[model samples]
Target chain A: MNYTSIECASSTSEQFVPMSPAKTLKVYWLETKFEWLKTIRNPAFALPAILFPVIFYLFFGVLMNHGNVQAASYLLSTYGTFGVMGPALFSFGAALAVERGKGWLDIKEASPMPASAQIISRLIVSMIFSLLIIISLGIIGVFFGGVELSVFQGALLSVILVFGGLPFCLLGLALGMMLKAESAPAIVNVIYLPMAFLSGLWIPITMLPNFLQTFANFLPPYHLSQLALKVMQQDVGDSVFTHLLALTLFAVIFFVFALVAHKRKQN
Target chain B: MQQVNSVKHSDASQVVASIQGLNKSFSNKQALCDVELQIKSNQVLAILGSNGAGKTTLINTLLGRLKIDSGEISIFSSQPGSLAVKQQTGAMLQVASLPETLKIREHIQLFQSYYPNPMDYQKVIAYAGLESLQERFSKKLSGGEKQRLLFALSICGNPKLLFLDEPSVGMDLSARQSLWKAIRDLKNQGTAIVLTTHYLEEADSLADEIVLLKQGAIIQRGTNEQIKACVSSTTIRFTTPSYPIDFNSVAYLISHDVSGKYTAIQTNELNQTLISLLTKYPELEDLSVSRAGLEEAFLELNKDQLAQSKTGKSVINKGEAA
Candidate 1:
């Protein structure tokens, strides 16, 4: 069959013909902003992600433990970790699973944007949600719980909680890749609620049974909480290196599983 | 607007996409066999098949969503899914679902940003007849509305090549007609299209070329008329006034449905059979020739194997013959 390629060269006039890094960056920014918008607008994710930790803190750290300075500082650090963890896991973990199940991921794969742009956007949005949670908790802590910290300590704690969401994001990725969309929310809750409590994010591990405290030594959130607590001079557990190593190990493990499952799905 | 990377070629036939020796499998079931196809610019190639017939796999491979086990595929002279090809290509996949939280306009704008050069968002909305639903959340739209939105997103990139997998699956009659008009407009503007659908009339109306896939292989490929004619035989019907049409004397006679008033005869060598019949029965009256419909041709061509796979999940005549 003879085919005439008339006007084939007209493709030259397209704006981003070469797809420069600048344009790629623009794609990342666009995806991130849209994702952030979707996150904030979704009551299923927004109400719980933004409000739950603050509400929980007001009830437990501020009201129940009113005028208890030590408990206020400890619970403030732990609740911040708990708060940051919800959005990270729900957004990356449950959202990705649902997106994958709905075939949205496939549509994304077929688009002109780079694959890394999708991940980068999700990561940035996760960080932003974590920041909002940390800031919200900080205000509630300073005013109501009377939890005090220097500027340096506050900055360090903010940094830890914001970035500390990474391991959970990786965990969510693995779960998203491995589990069904319907199962993701239930499974995340299963892992999240228990891990938070077991790791002493709800109550200090020191106050828990000795065996439970020993068990906290192995959990990622325990390390994250301890690092957050260190910001207020309230470190009750492992050395900073141990916490960092444990978190790093979880991140690596989750990352590997996510990569493997993702590859398997595509193949 | 994103400009795809340019690659010079000796042949200027504007091959929008091509695949050679393509093969893929899932576990023990082969999803795609050794398939080779070429698509030129401004052409619409309709892939026709039932469920599990490798239609989805072929579309997925072309879009670079699934890795080909072994084969060579290219779009615009670049590897499939390469940035250059991606900039110029668009797809509405069979399994795709849009985010419910986004409004119609947001979805279109977000997808348009992915491309370097895109049609104006308003033009896309106008083309898709999505003007009224622009500000409405996607979750509020009906099924047909969602399909239209997806179609709009696919074309918003000003893509040179578009893949629409059952693009009208959930559309109402009016919406489907409007979608067809939008697709025809794109084709008129020189966009090459690859469409897969269960609707035979869709292919008859839009496809410049048609490929009939059965069990991961192309059983037939041609223009609409050519495929309709290529079903291996046609049935000639006539009512004889005096002399009877003799079936034994005619060549390529496969069978006959003879009645006292009228008769229908099947023959592969339709011309020869007609010539013989005319010679034998000069008084034959009320004569007519009818070729099989594309749907019947499809079913008959793959009747044997399709009868065997026998799974009833997809659109079908399942387990009937098995």
Candidate 2:
């Protein structure tokens, strides 16, 4: 057909070059941040996660006070860790699973966006939501809750607690991508309530059964709570180092599985 | 933007995608077997198959969303799922389930930023017929509206290649027609399209080339005319009140569609068969003849697979592997 002859003499003729991997990832991150912003502005998506933490802080940290000042102060730290866990599990995890079920992940895959950006965006969004929860709870703990922690202590508590809670974030990410949406809320509840109770969110670990205390000591929530408590109390106990190591280990394992699961789903 | 110009303006005809000896197994079930295909630039290749015929699997392989047990697939001369190649492709998967809280316009804007130089925001909204629905939350949109929104997202990037996996599933007739028009326009703009649809008529109408898949394998690949010729012949339909006529009497007969007081004989010799049928069944009335369509060819292509499943030679079509 002599197809080349049509544009043979044209100086504008060019080859179809594709975008680089790094550029594609950059686009994905930008779009994802934009999505996070839109999600933030809607209030519908943001309200439940944000409100849940604030309400809990008001109720447990301020209203009830748990009778004992030290216990109330302890609850403040525990609840800060507990507060952000909601969005990490309910919002990010449930959303990931449901989106996968509905084939949205597949849609993104087909786009020119980088695959890593997809997961990275979700992680960043969840982390940001978690950070907000921590800061809000810390504020109530210092001001309204009548807790004696200083601004420096409260800020340090929030920072440690944010990263301390990463394992839970990765755990939620894995669970959300693995399970079905119908079972997501139920499954999240199953994970959430027991972990919170066992890890002493509702009760002090010292009051729990010896078996539960031992088991709770191994969980990520326990580590996060311990880290938050140490910073808020200005007491760096020997347990703090163990909790950090354990939480880091849990995050490493979880992150590996989540990446593997994502790759498996892709192919 | 400078990079965008350098990339998009390049020649795109040089075998942009190639699939060779692909094999995929999910646990115990083989979803794709020795599948081979190639897609060039500026061609709308329509993949036609019944539900669960590995259409999605093929797409997953091409996008490198699923790993194939044994196969080679490359996109734009690079490996499949390569960032360079994937970044140049836009896609509309089966159904979009974007966050319900995000408005349609927001969704469009978010996806647009993923490309260096996407189409204008107003143009995309207009293209997807979402001008009226742009303010509505994604959750509030009707099925057709959601489909349109998804379509709008798919083309906003001005991608060189587009993958539409059942893009018009929930669309209305007008929406479907408009989508087809949009698809044609994209093709005219030199975009390569790979689409899968349950609508055989849509395939016939829009596909420059058709690939029929069955049981994770390519059953037929050619233009509509060439594939239809696989079961080429005309169907002779007639009704008689006096007696029932057996189709065996006619030579060159392929099959029959029999109902109460009516029979349709599919034959290679349309002229001779019609004459024989009229003379033999003198009481015949309301006779009609028509060419075999993609539907008939599709049925013929899958008939053996269906029979094999029934006889327990193959797994049930709907059975999930453990």
Candidate 3:
């Protein structure tokens, strides 16, 4: 509408300066911060994510076990695995699918936000949820179930369970890219509940039938729960390297699936 | 001559982005065909077409969301999706939402972090008219308010080039007016803008140039006045008189329609047609003569395309309508 003003304004803002390292870091930081804030504020997601495993453990590990330390400690490892999987799976899988369907993902992609920031932010949130779940379960196990553990063993178990959620995160990422928004929650639940049961996260592999016990080897959550059990010396006597290798293999497979889905979406 | 002079004056530096012979297809359906476009600084180019006319497809290709099959797309002399191009570009796409939990100010703050040199916080809020609603969560906002928030995010970077696709779709009149004012301010700030809208009046008021697309091909390209001039015929409407006059003798008459009490005549030669009608009936009441607006011109152009298709004719002679 105004020609002179346009000519004047165009002259001043033409350069495309590169971002500084500090500014780039700030972008990642702020992205993660906002992502964390959004997730925590949603009661539907945060409430179930933090409370489910804690409640399940309090019921099965304490009230039913009647102060049996060995059962409490073993259930702690399994329930911790169960706890971490919820956040890692739903955050990456369901949230991502909704974002994609809403065109929110497209908006972010069109901006200068680094794609890695998105993935990294969700990973951090999942781990934070895992930490909260493990701590709550830990408090219940110590005070109610009388499970005994040195500080070192407790810390190692926490570290294993928190980091072991990586494979599930990758699996969720792959599903998120593939699933539609309206059906994402339903589909994710279908996959999650069965996988958790099959992996012996709800009950120990030894308690299952021979055929089902053998099937646990193929599920990523089984390997993660087994790794957590190793800290309590209650694992099925496999070397630590075996479980780690299995989780790594699953992560690699899921990562490839995620990559293929992402590439397919771009075209 | 004026277009040529404007082109020569702007030179290569003013051309922010260019698409040459672009072609894209989805399976058996072609989404774009041999498209060529140039986005110049300080200008608004409106792409107008009906649904499935490839407007969104073209915008997606420019945003690098869809890959073109054959063509050259250079934005800031780099590839479309490159960080360098994205840094200098902003877009307000047709989206269903922002993250529902985040407040407006939080969304703005997060988006601002994406760009290296972001606009000031207060300035972006003022430009998008989000001052009063800054504290509200995104999910609580109405459709128009959400559109405003999306607009704010798009301009958070103070981008040199902006792509707005149906930006005013759900906006109220006052909100739409403010959006237009903000667009004008951005244009004055030298932002090269590409707008696609169904509202012809919106395009007419904001666009320095308009591209009419049909069935994935550009049918016409010109300024508002130039495009309107393509229709040529003006309409003359008057109340029917008691005496029936022979209208066939009217010079340069395109058509005449008598509906109820009103007689409307369309002709290319406005002066001769009015004179002939007035001479026949000295007491012509409620007479009005008006040229075709952009909406009429657009429909006329599309009607011509339909006629051309039925007759097995081709009108792909680019820039001829101008």
> Highest TM-score, which number?
3
Q: Model 1's CAPRI class?
A: acceptable
**Residue-level error in angstroms, candidate 1, position B317:** 20
Off by over 4 Å in 2: A1-34, A37-48, A65-67, A142-144, A232-236, B1-14, B239-254, B260-262, B280-283, B305-322
- Per-prediction TM-score, chain A only? 0.92, 0.83, 0.94
Interface RMSD of each: 3.9, 5.8, 6.3
In order, the TM-score of chain B in each prediction is 0.77, 0.87, 0.87
- Residues A1-267 of candidate 3 have per-residue lDDT tens digits of 122322432333345678899998998898889999999999999999988899999999999977888999999999999999999989999999999999999889999999999999999989999999999998889888898877998899999999999999999999999999999999999999999899888788899999998988999989999899988899998889999999999999999999999999767
Query: What local lDDT does model 3 show for residue B97?
Result: 79
Worst 10 residues of 1 chain B by lDDT: B313-322
Q: Provide the global lDDT of candidate 1 against the true structure.
A: 0.82
**All models, DockQ values?**
0.34, 0.32, 0.42
Candidate 3 chain A, run of 10 with poorest lDDT: A1-10
How well is each residue in A1-267 modelled by candidate 2, as lDDT tens digits? Answer: 123322321221133345567766667677667658656866755897788768876887678865456766888888877876777776657777877788777677677665667666766777788888877876776677667887788778777766665777788888877888778777888998789888877677778898998788667887788777787552336476687788889999888887787766654
Regions more than 4 Å wrong, model 3: A1-14, B1-13, B237-265, B269-287, B304-322
TM-score of chain A of 3: 0.94
In candidate 2 chain B, what residue range of length 10 has the lowest lDDT sum?
B313-322
Q: Write the per-residue lDDT of candidate 2 for residues B48-110, one digit (tens) a residue.
A: 878888998888778767777998886666666766666567778776577677788878877
